[model samples]
Target: MNSLPPLRQPCPPGTCTCRRDELLEEPGADLRILRLTRHEEQRLLERLENIRSLADLERLQQRMYEQLGIRLSVSPSHNEVRSMRGIVIDFVEQPGLCRKTRQAIPAAIRRGLERQPEIAYRLLDAHDLLRDA
Candidate 1:
């Protein structure tokens, strides 16, 4: 068995489920939070309404970085350093996604995020902080 702890979903506190999504709008203690500008929100929502495949999700992810300047490198639980791809994968899998796309988003996101880098959670340990102590 792998000695590493299981990866926690990168959902922000209280916003993991669709039931509490309003809290996401208000913001909370997510490590790498993506704060959206009004125009970006509008554009993202419009794009989400039409997402049907992995490509669509990838395109939106790129658009957020390129156009809106929104990118989050989240440390989900102080162990996992999730890149933008991982963050976007988590975001795209939210319940807000259309029902037609919901079931497949997780798998798609997994494939995409895995392609980004190794599954190793790059975290800072006490040793690194105080070397030779």
Candidate 2:
């Protein structure tokens, strides 16, 4: 007789065992969302290299606000903005690019935006950094 609780069936590797995991991992899981591109990744990595401290991150944050036309006072709790700021700071602090950047940055950026249009259209239209948005 089995003494322990019956083992649960293992989820298939390609199956959606966890909706949250699927949402987090799949790039094309949702079409309405704005995704981060390689150019933005490269740009962030390159620009972040110049930042060596929190002061630099703060300056960059200001620049992002000015350049991206983001008003923190208006959008006091914007995640997309904060995500971008964090990405730059995290990238700079590390010696090299994090392997998880491609997946992580876009997700973070999406989280930070108050609306899909903010990233899907407006920011892309305003900023020249993105190769194609």
Candidate 3:
């Protein structure tokens, strides 16, 4: 009779099933082995720099809306605006939008404007204020 090696226990719920030894044995096992080009690195750095703080992120969102006719809502309350920046970043990273950030923006703005013209007008007003400043 042939004897079998010990069987490993299953992973906990929601955990990956692959064993650490199995993963390590694979060539180029890490996802980040595919590296970014110099330009891609620079762009990533720029994006990171752009969102250093809530105020900076808010300005960025407003600029996107103003320049590209994309209407995104920032909260009326200052505290809410700070919290919403993280949400905005997540929204921008969502997949299946044709990889054209500018393209989806205008449509988003249009939809928001249709639902809440006052918000759109407020964004425009903020743009004017920034321009004057």
Tens digits of per-residue lDDT for model 2 on 1-133?
8674222232345542223343446664431111223455457545544444434434655664454322222111223334333222222221122235533543444444423333333443343434444
Return whichever of 1 and 3 wins on TM-score: 1
Q: Alpha-carbon error at 116 in model 3, in Å?
A: 31
Report the CA-based lDDT of candidate 2 relative to the real structure.
0.37
- What TM-score number comes out for model 1? 0.27
lDDT of 3 at 95: 16
Candidate achieving higher TM-score, 1 or 2: 1
Off by over 4 Å in 2: 1-35, 61-99, 102-133
Pairs that collide in candidate 1 are none
RMSD of each: 15.9, 17.6, 16.6
Question: Which candidate has the highest TM-score of all?
Answer: 1
TM-score each candidate: 0.27, 0.25, 0.25
Clashing pairs in 2: 79-112, 80-112, 80-113
Candidate 3: tens digits of C-alpha lDDT, residues 61-129 = 675445322334543332223321222322333111122332344444344444545544454456453
